[model samples]
Target: MKPIDPRLLRYARATRLFLTAVVALGAVGAGLLVAQAMLIAEVVVGAFQHSMAAAELRTPLLLLVAVACGRALVGWLTELAAH
Candidate 1:
C-alpha cells in the first residue's frame, strides 16, 4: 500500500466535514418534513384548514442542492490542494 501524506489527511478531513454537514442537513430536512406533515394532518383533522404554514421549503432544498454541489467543489478543491 502507498503511504499517506499530511496534505492528503487535511483534504480528507475537509471532505469529511462537508459530508457530515450534508448528513446533518439531510436529517434536519427530513425532520422538517415529518413535523410539517404531522402539523398539516392535525390542522386538517382538527380545523379542516388547507394551507401551508411554511411555504419556503425551497430554501433548505436549495441548500441541500448546494451541499450536493459542494461535494464536487470541495472534492476538486481537496484534490488540488492536496497535490
Candidate 2:
C-alpha cells in the first residue's frame, strides 16, 4: 500500500489517546471500587477490634468516597483534554 498522510497519522494518534483514556477510566473505576470495599472493611474491622467510635468512621468513609469521585472526575477531565 501507499504511504498515509500526516493528517491521517494525527487521527491515529488521537484515536490511540482516546482509547488510552478509556482504558484508564476502566482501570481507575475498578481500582476505586476495590479500594472502597477494602476501606469500608478496614473501618468496620477496626471499629470492632479496636473500638473506634461512630464519628471516627464517618470522616474516613466520606473521605474515601470523595477521593473515588475525584478519580472519576480526573478520568473525565483527561478524556475531555485529550479531545
Candidate 3:
C-alpha cells in the first residue's frame, strides 16, 4: 500500500475540529435515540403487560420526553456544524 501524503494531512487539519464535533454529536444522537426507544418500550410494557398506573409510569414518560428533546437538540447541532 502507498503511504499517506503530507499535503493531504495539511488540508485536513482545518476540517478536523468540525469532524470531531460532528462525530461527537452523532454519538450523542444515537445514544439519545436508544434511550428514547428503551423508554417507549418500558412505558408500553409497564402499561400493558404490568398494568402500571399513570403515576407509576410518570418517571419513564418524563425521561422519554427529555431524551426526545435531547435528540432534537443534537440534530440541530449536527446541522449547524455541517453548514
Q: Which candidate is the best by lDDT?
A: 3
Report the candidate with higher lDDT, 2 versus 3: 3
Q: How do the residues 1-81 of candidate 3 rate in per-residue lDDT, one tens digit apiece?
A: 999999999979978888999999999999999999999999999999999999999999999989999999999999998
Tell me how candidate 1 scores on lDDT.
Answer: 0.56
Candidate 1 local lDDT, 1-83, one digit each (tens): 98989999998887886666666655655665565566445545444344434334444445545655555565555455444
Can you rank all candidates by TM-score, best first? 3, 2, 1
Tell me the lDDT of model 2 at 70. 71
- Give per-model TM-scores: 0.45, 0.55, 0.84
Q: Output the number of the TM-score-best candidate.
A: 3
lDDT digits (tens) for residues 28-55 of candidate 2: 7677778878888878887999899978
Model 1 worst lDDT window (10 residues): 46-55
lDDT of each: 0.56, 0.79, 0.94
Query: If both were scored by lDDT, which would come out higher, candidate 1 or candidate 3?
Result: 3
Error of 1 at 61 (Å): 21
TM-score of 3: 0.84
TM-score of 2: 0.55
Error of 2 at 54 (Å): 1.3
- For each candidate in turn, give its C-alpha RMSD to the true structure in angstroms: 9.3, 3.8, 2.8
Candidate 3: segments with Cα more than 4 A from true spot = 1-11
